[model samples]
Target chain A: MFNYLKPNNLLKIINKTQKFVFIIFLVIISIGLVEALILSPEDYKQSDSVRIMYVHVPAAWISLGIFSLIAVLSFGILVFKNKNLSLITKSLSPSGFVFNVIALVTGSIWGKPTWGTWWAWDARITSMLLLAFFYLMFLLSWRVTDDEKKAVKISSYIAIIGLINVPIIKFSVEWWSTLHQPSSVNIFTETSIHASMLLPLGIMTAAFALFSLLIFLMKYNTELIKIKNKGLDRL
Target chain B: MYGKKVKLRAIFILSIFFSLILIVFLVFKSLEENVVYFKSPTEIKDLTELTSKKIRVGGMVKEKSINVNQSEVNFVITDFKNELIVNYSGSVPNLFEEGKGVVAEGFLKDRNFFTAVKILAKHDENYMPPEVEEAIKESN
Candidate 1:
């Protein structure tokens, strides 16, 4: 089973899976865009500007979700000293950073028309900005260190430290008075959103998740190629 | 030996993770006042003394309480229990209306009145088609 984890075998698996993931991502995103933009209902008050929620909400969720995954994987690396897990985290951060930027920029644009201000130092917004910085630090730790062991150790510590921000970001609105409203969708309680808009949101979140998977596969495949070029047999 | 080392490392990592959470939890608790984006009208009304410091008061705009004049606009902000009259001299956001959420940024004149320099419309979490909203409004 361990021999099956070699770069040559992993590269073959990645190559086959990447193409299918890309195709699926493209199909889901196309359907999601149509649903979010064309079929979703215009907001009662915000009008067309509310459409930004489709992109903003999903992007925010993806960024937060990826960071939490990275934190958990980093914990695994710390305990088990898994080399492959570190590589996976290194590949995942770029897509996570991109989505973080998309969420912040789209949110700013949404705020201007609705809130009468482009930015506010509200709890939710500020914590999200901190999360972007945490992603930056985690990405930087990987590049700034030369030794593989050093890079892995430094990045793992950074992730663990950053993990604290994830819960803070989630509960920011509930814990403080934020310019942003409290969550309308809850799993345990009733959801305030109408089904028409909720449908688009759900579809868009699925599409974004698939798109992130495509990015991760391509990135992980490249890492495998590099290892194969270096004449390494296993991670 | 290797298994024992890994076990120790796992304990170390979990301890570190929990401690970091504890430290941050305390820090956020300490900075509670600063993190609050706005105060409600009820909170303002409960204040024993009013200060001229710039603050944000947020609540629903009372129906039939908005009075617009050439120089300034006055409206009452209500939390359904306590109400504060706000005077502002600026353009309001598009979502500002009676029976809607708002946050006024300015100074407090007294316990019952606030002087605002800027008005921000706070939108609720509800989203639906305009027709559906209209129907809901009619039934109300």
Candidate 2:
């Protein structure tokens, strides 16, 4: 399984899968946007402003999801001493950071029309900002450390410590008096959203997940190439 | 040597964890006082004392209770059993109207009077906009 970490093997996998993944991502995203923006009914209270939910919710979902992935991968790195897991974690962080940024920006825009404010120090928003800081710290750990081995260890620790913020972000609305509303969709029980709205949101979420996977694969391939070049320099 | 280095690293990491826990605890404790719990007009009326601290009052706008002045709007928030007057000077949201659920965030002047710095309109999950409803009615 670790043989896949080799540069030549990763290049072969990327060559075979990249085009297919790109086409699938593009097609799904295009269909999802049309369904979300046009096919879905306007919200009774928010009107068209609710359309931002299609983008905002998925971005927030991806951000949280990817950070959790990094945390798990970090565990694998420490427990199994798996270099491959570290590479994958490194690849996923930028996408997670980008999604976190998108979620914050879109949420601010959505808040203005509904909550009559661009920003608030509410628990939900503040926890999300904390999550963003964790992502930044994870990225910065790699940059500031000169020792490759030490960088991996530090970043892994950062990811594990930061995992606490994920649950806080998820439950902030329910646990505190926040301006942001509670989640419309809940996993333990029935979602509050109607099926008509759920379908488009589902599509967009799938598209975003697939898109993040594409980015991860590209980043993994680049990291493998860098490792190969470093080995050559050592020789 | 390897075991000793590992022990030091473990201690460092554990210290970081404990410090982070302490920070979060302190932050939440301080913020607890600042966090204003949402209350309904009925709940507010039942309160033993009305402090001047900021709070949020949420309930439906009473029918024909809104009076829009040149700079300020005065309205009544009702939970059917009780009603509280809310005074706001900033522009109201587009969805804010009679019978809609609203959350007013500000200091309470008294059980009968509340001054709102911000107003958030809450809507039900139903998708029947007035224009869409009118269109469907005409077609029917």
Candidate 3:
């Protein structure tokens, strides 16, 4: 069953669904924008500046989510010899790196008004910076070598090693006395964020997830085309 | 064959190097004093000995404690367990307010008073509309 999802089948599926994915992305993003900017009330303290959270938080979430997925897929690639997953981990990275940069940039912009500093060597901020470096090193591991076998092994190892920083980034605020506050959005317990704000945040996160999916489809299709051009029947 | 060996060696070395870095970071995390961005007023008071080095004392600015004279500002940061007086002459962050979270950065004058050079406003995790906040306040 898994064999049927060969590179050729992926190409066909990608071409058929690309436009629909794009349309859905656009529609969700539009709704997200309205909900985040207008419908959500201004924060009692931060006021209009709080609106920046709509983009910053979603971008951070998407970046972290994508990296976690890549790490898991890399683990399969190394241990189970699932070569097909390498293409996925490869294609997923550019959007992940882009969102990582977006999160950092937006966080910097948000910090200037709230924390009175554009940047700080705070624990959470530094760990996030380290994650970006990991993403960079993973992306570079592919280009630095032309041999696909070498590239896959090196990149997978990098992913597995970099995953140690993920939890550190998540808990940096609680572990240390950082400038950033504790997370309000809890999963196991009641969330501190109000329903009005969480609603927009959820929509924005969905839109961003769809957008990353669209990006992945295009990149995956291109990789498949490359394989087909080389007369390779399998990836 | 020689080139292949070199490439393999390079990959081996790189993996070891990255793994070592992660291990070092994990080991370093155990030592908390080196990493804290700021210390609460109570934590500062509990210290066995005070260092002359610059440190940030963080907590809530006690209500009615803010005294602004010209460019100088004085306030008391309390953790509800202990309080520290901070005197500084600086333009504070926009969010700085009485009864709000704050962090003062400067050298300590003594155990009870600090000579601050900068004031940063800190906020809680709670976020809501002004109206909603007012209503909650009224209901309370």
Best by lDDT: 1
Residue B71 alpha-carbon offset, candidate 2, angstroms: 4.2
Interface root-mean-square deviation (Å) of every model: 1.0, 4.3, 5.0
Q: Which tens-of-lDDT digit does each residue in A27-74 have in candidate 2?
A: 999999999999988876677988898999999999999999999888
Return the interface RMSD of model 3. Answer: 5.0
Name the docking class for model 2.
Answer: acceptable
- List TM-scores of chain B, every candidate: 0.92, 0.68, 0.79
lDDT: the better of candidates 1 and 3: 1
Those runs of model 3 whose alpha carbons end farther than 4 Å from true positions after fitting are A1-4, B1-26
Per-residue lDDT for A1-235 in model 3, tens only?
4445667777878898999999999999999999999999899899999999999999998999999999888876765556678989999999999999999999999988998888877788998999999999999998999999999999988887788778888989887888888888888877878788999999999999999999999998888888889997876
lDDT digits (tens) for residues B1-98 of candidate 2: 34665566556666776788778768877877455347788878888988887788888899999999899999999989999999999989887899
Off by over 4 Å in 2: A1-5, A232-235, B1-31, B35-56, B62-64, B69-71, B78-83, B123-140
Q: Assess every candidate by TM-score.
A: 0.96, 0.84, 0.92
What are the per-residue Cα lDDT tens digits for candidate 1 across B19-136? Answer: 9888888987898878899999888877887877999999999999999999799999999999999999889999999999999999998988899999998888888898888899
Clashing pairs in 2: none
Candidate 1, residue A40: how far the Cα is off, in Å: 1.6
**Per-prediction RMSD in angstroms?**
1.6, 4.5, 4.8
List candidate 1 segments past 4 Å from native: A1-4
What tens-digit string does per-residue lDDT give for candidate 1 at A116-136?
999999999999999999899
Cα deviation at A83, candidate 2, in Å, is 1.3
Best by DockQ: 1
